[model samples]
Target chain A: MSAERQERIEARIAQLNAEMQKREDYQAIIRLQRAYGFYIDKGYWREASDLFTEDATYEQGVDGVFIGRERIHQVIVKLSGGNPGPGLPFGQLYERFQLQPVITVSDDGQSAFGRWHELAMLGQYGEHAEWGEGVYENRYRKEGGVWKISALHYFPNFVAPYEGGWAVLKPVEGDWRSPELADFPPDAPPTVNYKPFPDQFTVPFHYPHPVTGKAVA
Target chain B: MSEHLLDALEAHLDSIELRIARQASHEAIERLQRSYCYFIDKGLWTAASDLFADDATGEWGQSGVYRGKERIRSYLALRGPEGLGQGELNTHITCQAIITVADDNMSAKARWRSDNMHCTDGTGSWSEGTYENIYVNDGGVWKIASMHYYVTLICDYDKGWIAGDIPMDPPSETLPPDAPPTEVYESLPGAYLPAYHYPNPVTGEQPKKPDLPELPESGEDTLADAVAALSTRVERLEDQRACEKLQRSYGFYVDKAMWNDVSDLFVDDSTLEIGGRGVFLGKKRVLEYMGIGLGPTGPQREQVINHQQFQGIVTVAEDGKTARGRWRAFVIGGSSWAPVNWGDCLYENHYKKVDGVWVMDKLHAPFTMYTLYTDGWHKATTPNTRPESFPPPPDLAPTVVYLTYPNYYCEPFHYPNPVTGKEAPPPNPAAGGVANMADFASEES
Candidate 1:
């Protein structure tokens, strides 16, 4: 190719990268973070799966090596459907994540990651409550002109039990009133609230695998 | 973050990657705790020695001295199983274990039971203790670096009281002398007696079905099941630790001035070392030391006693059975000339799992420095306890005894000092041996 043409090509590439940083894309990244926390808190496994790219990496739990969308789904499944609250019984939980400090864009303008110090808790559906406290190390990438979660990590600082046992989730502090939760019989036992106390933090998916950036087929 | 800065940061991180590899796991914590306890419980000196940093300064309770890891290891070998057989084995049952990871998860504070135990066999044997530990997670493994084992209760059953039943052996030097006519009894009287029999309650005989409490059966779960079960265990441990009710209980022991509860913090045949005060052999001696030193009759002489500046650090080993800690205490002793300045030495502790529960086996108080009205106190605080120039005390000397409270009156005497009434020149404490507060005072004065 001619030198002039080469310069033009490079210029075009830069322009395209800049175009990827549209306001919508930034908002989408924020939504991705919110969706990840929301789905997990509300037990919306399927929706949470869609927030990530088909082949995106998801690291969950203290060990951190837990990887892959399938593995991520597995952890979500274990968390949502397994012992303790197991989701459905808890109703549609209203989950809120307060992102703090500031979320930054990538220098290359192609990828961005947010180190969010999150204070998250859960309660019965329609109840404004919390379960415990933790923080998130989240990553986002612009793929096919859209921002999607490339990697998501969660770290817990403390795991204190809620009043309603290990299943019924409760926040540390907040006025959580759930009038809609009256569907359960007045004599219904409170759901067990389960919390995981993490000591070891491992990189998700300890199994050796190439870091593939291409979307999953 | 700039690429250059990020790359530099990553490189720095890589250099210290070796530390990351040694980061302690929950299991490693449990193992270290178990190893230390086993070292004390079964007297597995070799295994116990391997659990600490090679260059560690260990206090095997007050009984084991601290110099280097090698010295501690040798000491363990020298004080083998013979030291273990005395106390009826009791397990440490931890309901909550709180760990804070440092140096990439190599160190932590593991706090659990503030409760103590009394012998069911009426032998009056008990092991009540507390711990604050600083650990190093080495290569994904947890090893104790420094541990403070505070024996809140260290009482033993009178062997003479249960001679025929329970096949009681005469109290070894390693065990506490709970018999009558001993000097310790002269100071703290009526503190020991048989609690309950291990065998049938009526016969007062060693129960064939030993009355040892049964541990809750872990649900049928394989190692793979640990993925879930371990998570639950970790969570439960954390919650138990966070509960204010539990932490408040720990404050109770120190606040209530229950030093005899030291034995309950450790397993049977556990050792405790007081850097200044002479080493106390077993749980029995531990109780004696506390009763005579920190207890009501000790320097802590006061009717409305108050011990301020109490802080503790607990390190729960990955193995679960063993944990270590350091508890700092600022004591106020109202003497005539000047108030006594005492800092309870850091305790090096080892917990073991006997029948699946954690119990302390060896505890050591290695570093204690007191500021007295006398000038000798400054030199007394040095790490070294044995001084070269000081001659050894005679094999046995009359023990120090004094009355308690308002009628308190006792004579001040120097240890290793000839009773002939002549004080020797100060010695170089650098040469480690075994010296007491008297030696420290004489050298400083």
Candidate 2:
């Protein structure tokens, strides 16, 4: 057996392992995002917040920006109807069904960005039930051998009444920011100004079309 | 050694190719079926029919069977030309599926649900159906072997279902089908369930009755199905999963403040008791209590209350008709304007199987503790909500009244403890297996 042959065999194995690891990482990052979504759905604010890095930025729709893990955690707790701690309060349904994830890992495998569609079933028992459609362009960091959210951004397309649905949805009244978070205040202004539903905003695609390999405008 | 490595590499490549081939079969069938629907949506009869194999059989509702690729094209061509006109809208959105590729990789079966809309001239109609179709691998390209489209209903766009069901036209007068209807059955009003090509993936259980006659070389149990059936644990796991799904789904519904969806989880005569607010009898009565107490229906602009259900201990009855579960919920309540609070509760719930569907028959929840998020349980505590706290009262009075937080009340378990049946309890060992620093110190040095 030649030394060159052994070297070639070893290199082939290494290549396969690297490819497999990337696929595994893709699944793991998706799992992390999905778990984060489940935590948010159940109003497990602390759990949802823990999925982020120490320094992370959280932004949703026109809700400006909240920076830092602690601040973002507080904002997550506040944004999810202001019930803090282990669980959501009774009669509040904030189901964020994480769906259709298209993830892309960087060359180093240390960072990745995922585009996900969020079909949110939001409501309060007896109050008002809303069906929300949104897209998430989130960034994740691999630190300490675990994937965590680095920057979270969600483009809310619409939040319409469950009864009439999106068909009867009127345009946003103002900035679409929850009035409750007014006192908390965002660290920065919204990344972009946009209207949803009746109006249109294409949440930028993180990856190009598979076949065309052309950027999706 | 180099020869051995080369052989190993060959084996590895073979394994990868085998897995890829199976997956490719799934993708190919999905693409073929989806493309057929897309072509059909635009009245591209020739293009859609081209997807059919040389000797494929196509069945549409009560329409007689059309055999062969050319005959299939002729049948579809009855719908008119290549493409629809301006006001002539024909939209077909097909989604949700169960795809099964043969272990031999030569054949496949798929079930698809389609929602269709068609507007001819000015008259519009809606159509919905299930497609239990078959596909064959021709060399490497997959093509439709059998397309069985069982229509659920076709109704007027405005009137809907019973009020406006548009009956299926008899065999086209000019160009009739090759043969009689395969499995004749009426739409909507009739009870006709098409037999699934594959059994339950988990339990490997298929219902006793299968309506349609089998096609060639398919619908038989595969090796995976046989292996899945060998496990006695499958049925229990399936039952347990169903119960867990119910609890998780109920929790999510409540988290979004969707009482209507939450209430729908319960049976018509189900009973619910939240805290000491008393038992809310029947689904409607429970909903009435919520509608009256919680204020309105839907997402609250400022307030949020999430009853996060967790740690469910479910025990299915021997008959499998009923089940009891005990679950705990940690409540996060209040709004930005209002003071936020934390609460924990225990639930002893009962579920009953009706028409093969599991619905909550009884939801008995007992509040354990309630405290302000700012003040903490050690400092400030909120009293449990009561009957008088809300306006229109409950249907029944409190069953078991108890004090919450600063006080303790055990919510009795519905199932006996797993360890309770043990003859003896093991004594705790203090130091026998304890780690000694000296034992591992040499390795560290």
Model 1, B138-251: lDDT tens per residue?
554457775444433333333211121122122235533223212121101112221111111111221121122222234664222322333333323432222222223323
Fnat per predicted structure, each in turn: 0.00, 0.01
- Weakest 10 consecutive residues of candidate 2 chain A by summed lDDT: A208-217
Report the lDDT of model 2 for residue B259.
71
TM-score against truth, every candidate: 0.26, 0.48
Candidate 2 stretches with Cα past 4 Å from truth are A2-6, B2-9, B17-199, B202-445
For all candidates in order, the CA lDDT equals 0.37, 0.64
What RMSD value applies to candidate 1? Answer: 27.8
Per-residue lDDT of B126 in model 2: 58
lDDT of 2 at B92: 57
Query: What would the per-residue lDDT of candidate 2 be over residues A100-200, giving only the tens digit for each residue?
Result: 45677898889999876665556654456565666789999998777889999998776766443454555676767877687888999999788775554
- Chain B structural similarity as TM-score, candidate 2: 0.48
